[model samples]
Target chain A: MIELNDYLILSGLLFTIGLVGVLRRKNLLMLFFATEVMLNAANIAFAATSHYYNDLSGQMFAFFIIAVAASEVAVGLGLLIVLYKRHGTLDLDNLASMKG
Target chain B: MYEQIAFYLFSVLIIGLFLVTVLTKNVLYSMTSLAAGMVLIAGIFFTLGADFLGVVQLIVYVGAIMALYAFAMMFFDVTKDVKENNTNGSLIFLLGGLTALMFVIIMSAPIMSENIQALYPPMAGVTNPQAVGMVLFTKYLVPFEVAAVMLLVAMIAGIILAGKKMDQSLTTEDDVIVEIDILEEDEK
Candidate 1:
């Protein structure tokens, strides 16, 4: 039998992978992708908990998270395009014009 | 028995595909893997009997979101490899490991408690979608409407931001080169 802990563990592992991507990647698009992975990880945890506990709240939270992620992507990708247009490169190191 | 096998299989596939999504240098490869991973995650939702959520995941994440990303990717040179400078590998490992450990401990803590009870348990005869609709309409109606408004704002913002230079072809823009040169000089 697959325990609830197993699903939680999987969620944790995926979250870690996403964190690594966020920390290590320099490409702005890849960073956004990493955030998406983290969001999905949280969704898994919430959905699994909802399933095991027979609660609708966790799934509802997951639904809201999805909605927020969609909006985030819309705004974020727009910002990315603008930034890319100005900078000509997506490298985080190169985009560091605000470094004091 | 079948659930166990399916769960294990989907778990492995989902994790592996996400790893590829995170670690791959090629954006195309990463995008493809992420989409596949998302589809499998919907499969996981289905396995958990969240039939409505599974379908939503399929339609939203795999269909709408990924398609938006693929469309946006057209503005960039997808053939070029993404270059990253990892100056401190140990710091990343240490941070990632610590966060992972913390997440695992906090998430699994509830599993040991064994006292959690469902607040809104599903009706015995109701389908997953029906139950979700009932709770959503009655309890979450306001938030759903708010989410719709937020999406509308985001759409307008995206359109305004990206529509600035819509007439200029990204690949064959002489002014873009001139602008980059000016910006580089400003930096120097």
Candidate 2:
């Protein structure tokens, strides 16, 4: 039988990988992808726990999370398009126009 | 035995695809990998008996969001090769590892100490989708309505932002004159 710890551990590892990607990647799009990975990691944790505890609230949270993620990507990609138009590049190094 | 094997397989596939999505320099490849990873996550949901969530994940993430990503990718002249210059790589790894270790320790602490009993054991005959729907509409009615509104607002915002003229330098007077000229030309 698969234990709850096993699922939690998997989630932790996935979240770690996403954090590394977020820290190391320079492209905004890649950052968003990493963020999605992290969100999925959380969703897995929630679902696993909900299953272990025999609760439906966790799945509901995951459902809402998916909805929020969809809206976020829509707005974020729109912003990315506008940013690329203004800056001509998506490289983080060149997008430091607001540097203090 | 089969459940354990399937769990491991889905986990491995998801992690590998996510790594490709994050580490690859090619944006299109990354998007493809992301979509694959999401589908694999839905597989994991199915293994865990969250059938409704698994199908919803397939529809929302792998279907709708990824389609939008593919459409957006076409608008940008993304470079085929992207060079990454990570200066503080070691420092970042050190901090990230420490944080992850902390998170794992904190999260697992409760499970390690306490014997948590499941309040609602998985009902073999109960339909997962119907149960989820019952709670969603009854207990979460307000939040559901709010989510619908939020999606609507996001749709409007995305269209407005992406459809705006790229040349922001054009004055309002110039824009009005150009619109007027186009209207007059249309009438002629």
TM-score of chain A, all candidates: 0.97, 0.96
> Which prediction has the highest TM-score against the true structure?
1
- Give the CA lDDT, 0 to 100, for residue B167 in model 1: 83
lDDT of 2 by residue, B38-114 (tens): 99999989988899999999999999999998888877876577778889988988887789889888877877887
How many clashes in candidate 2?
A: 0
**Recovered share of real interface contacts in candidate 2:** 0.71
Query: All models: lDDT?
Result: 0.89, 0.88
Candidate 1, which CAPRI tier? medium
lDDT of each residue in A1-100, candidate 1, tens digit only: 9877788888888899899989889999999889999999999999999998889988888899999989899998899889888888888898778899
Q: Which pairs of residues collide in candidate 1? A: none
Question: What digit string (tens of lDDT, one per residue) describes model 1 on residues B55-168?
Answer: 999999999899989988987877877888789988997899798888778767766788787888888899999999999998889999999999999999999988896787
What ranges in model 1 sit over 4 Å off?
B107-115, B167-188
